[model samples]
Target: MPPLLAPASRSPWASLPEDLVRLVSWRLLAGDLTDYVRLRAVCTNWRSATMSPCGRGVIDPRFHPRRWMMFAEGHGLYPGHERLCEHTRFLNLDSGFFVRVRLPLFKDHCVLDSVEGLLLLQRDEDTAIRLHHPFTGDIVELPPLASHNLHMSHPYANLPQLRPISASVSIDAGVVRVMVIFIHLMYAAVATSQDTKWTYLMHWRLPSHYGPLSFRGEQYLVHETMNIENTYLSQIFQLEAHSQDPPKLIVTFPREKLCYPVYLVECDTEILVVGHNDISLTHLAVYKLADVVLDRFIPVKSIGDKAIFVGGRNLCVSSKALPTIVGDTIVYRHPREQHFMQYCLNTSSWSLATDECSTM
Candidate 1:
């Protein structure tokens, strides 16, 4: 005969072996850094067993927010909507899933640009700049643009004087390098984690440049200029990181079309040129490298199961991860439109993305 005894309470998640937890955490980190973060938040034991994204720092490639884009949710907020608005909504371009995260950085900073899920945030108080990863809550500070000696001035001193046209960040072996292109500055600014002040690269000849697009650890920019023949010309320039030397020109070609706003996106193994045929944002022409030596691009009708999310930094994602997203399509938001839109390369048609992918 034995007395009845209550069963000991235990959490299966907490009891998971440390070695198994580490393996699972690393596997999740490779695919989705957000998921790996959630796994750690499950229990104290699990958190201790997993490698913290913050511990490794934002420079670590494992902490990169891959295939994630912050959603633009501009809507009137009421009392009931407070909770919904408290968290920032990030959409997974590959899986079509929404991840809600509370970021304090957004409260006091305005996002100047975003690349590979890293936000170039400027503080509202003094326009101080910082690189932030929303998922990992990691931050790297940079000196304010005004702190640098620039003689340009205008009568409207009260207004926002300077703004970053575009920015690119490259991280290698825990070393971080940032390149910023300004709207009115003749020189581009380059800085590293080791530098206290920005290094001005005064060798750029073109006044209008689209991007310092990072492809395979190298930075590239589409330098557009008007020729004396009354035609537009675009040249590709490779920006050398951690160097004060001038950007190296990769190729030069005349633009047959007046494609005003162009984007150079890094796809899996190739670099893509995406542009709007007109200001209406209705038509898009996608191009890929045809000749490596010549740097010639050819129009492409399809990109297989890959999808491109267009923005300041265009992202290319595989649709196979989530069949919900239509493959071979470009997802973009028009400057005049309130919601997002999609252009299907296969059909050469346009559709409203709000119906398929709703923002927060």
Candidate 2:
């Protein structure tokens, strides 16, 4: 085949299957998803696909869509034969349905990402991929990380002490870039080693030659973790690949002191971040990776419900109101501004614009 291109008269998106439109559009709307569980549940067109992720594009249009989630097969960390997981189940917000895809290799700990109709996964140190086909159980493996730094995941016996661990992957310039942000959580309990208690932001190429690996921009990010005081705050850094020297880092605060789950969503222009799960993150804010001053929490009244991600571009932060419990934290939309509203659930309503990290 020479090449397939959609007619110029038609918008590329015009010819896209309704499923494609919804998938891409949802990612544009929802930032970092807790899981793409709901999106994948719509209809058979959204779920059942034949051929190798059939579409006119060079890559499988279905699998390579922006944001997707995978389940790590087992209790341990990393994926492999023991760790079996697949991206079959999809949650559709349009219709309340959960589609399930049965797969293996997501055994131990499978980190899944969808690209070009194929599900790419990372298990511990290695990488692999599988194509989605309903009738047949077909899968292919990719290559592994280019290099391994034992220091990245230093075992207690191997190094003086391994304090912290963090990893982020970004696909830039057609390659999958991987970076690990390690922090010194503890001093050596045993011998004395000159281990600096600084965060190491490391990167690597996904030169996964081991299995059905065809990843391009697999590079690791190297940077230092930022901490306000001696106490580690509830924050994590986002890696930007297209920067000078090493990629740029965007550190965000979810909850003040607790290490709750922080999600980083890459919208078409702005990066949307949601800090949830931990009750301390009753606040939400947006920021540009380049502008530090623009980063601040949105002032709002706190709701007493555990804000489980409901759906859509909007998020509902809620908690349980107990008679004896007193509000300790206040949500200020404009913390730097003079006015402060002690976050009360009923009075707060706000959204962040995707084009810019400004109030909506």
Candidate 3:
């Protein structure tokens, strides 16, 4: 018999097939976006694989610390050139450069929130929606609710089946795909933590606006919640549209009796943002479409308390908190630690490069 010999060492990465490796590389480029952005524009294969569920992946352990800010300056010589106009307009938040879009003008509007590379700006109640890419100046106008069909006649029953509409954007490789979701759940997550995790909501594909069955539209709104109950809510009610046909409610928060302001933030994931209200004893209620259902809330106080983000193997929040006149306001977070230790988005987050972040 041959002398016993030590088993040959197995290479940890040797068993993974080439296709699996390709998928993973593509996923890393897409999922680990803090660094992979430059690579996304390198090839079409990488671009296609990362823009969808099949080839896409969740946030990478090695990603984040993405220090993206709106830049405002450009080469001075070509100030008036048509090609250089993109860097000339001003966005709601002064990211440094001016942002000019070619969509119809909106009035009494507010820039709600944004994700990926998209901005969720709303005006005229969600009846009129616009999907615009900040860099490319591409705009897609979302269709009005099914109720808008009644202008032809008061016979509102002829309106097609109404479904909740919302928008989401994900960056894969370098390709930014703006997605439209027509589903029942405002947010999707695995029903349980221990099993195969899959988004619990069903993705309903209505005919695109190009087809005969097309009653579809899109927007950049986030935190879309609706209460199927029959309760008239407040403040948020100011954003409603007036028409013979009522706009179908989209579940935004989850409840109605919300007595306080439900603080909302666009974190890295979609979770029911409930607060512990370290300061106040009341739970703030914002509108979820229209009805009020306090039971649907995830019991917490001031609103969403924990925001889970990561940078490489390190899991952390994007910002930090410091003692302020009011209370503990987020100081500077991880990737942006060098600045903005006391400011937040839409507030003093960008008042100036050197102004005290204490007040925006």
Question: Against the true structure, whose TM-score is highest?
Answer: 1
* Per-model TM-score on C-alpha atoms: 0.71, 0.37, 0.33
Local accuracy of candidate 2 as per-residue lDDT tens digits, 112-176: 43432234344543322223322134343233322233334554344212312232333323333
Compared with the true structure, all predictions reach lDDT values of 0.70, 0.33, 0.31
Residue-level lDDT of model 3, residues 1-360, one tens digit each, is: 967744432343434454764566656644434225444444554444344322222222123212222233466423234455423343321112234543233233333323333444445454443444444344444443332333323243522222333444333343333333333323211111112222323332222221010011122222223246653222221111111122233433323334222332333332222222322322222222212233353432221332222111111133222111222123222232344333232232322223664333
For model 2, give the 10-residue run with minimal summed lDDT: 186-195
Please give me the total number of clashing residue pairs in predicted model 2.
73
Q: Rank the candidates by lDDT, best first.
A: 1, 2, 3
151-270 in candidate 1: lDDT tens per residue?
333332522545655676777777788777665554567777677677666545434576557654456777777789876666677765555567777766546532656778877658
What clash pairs does model 1 have? Answer: none
TM for candidate 1 is 0.71
Task: Return whichever of 1 and 3 wins on TM-score.
Answer: 1
- Cα error of candidate 2 at position 187, Å: 16
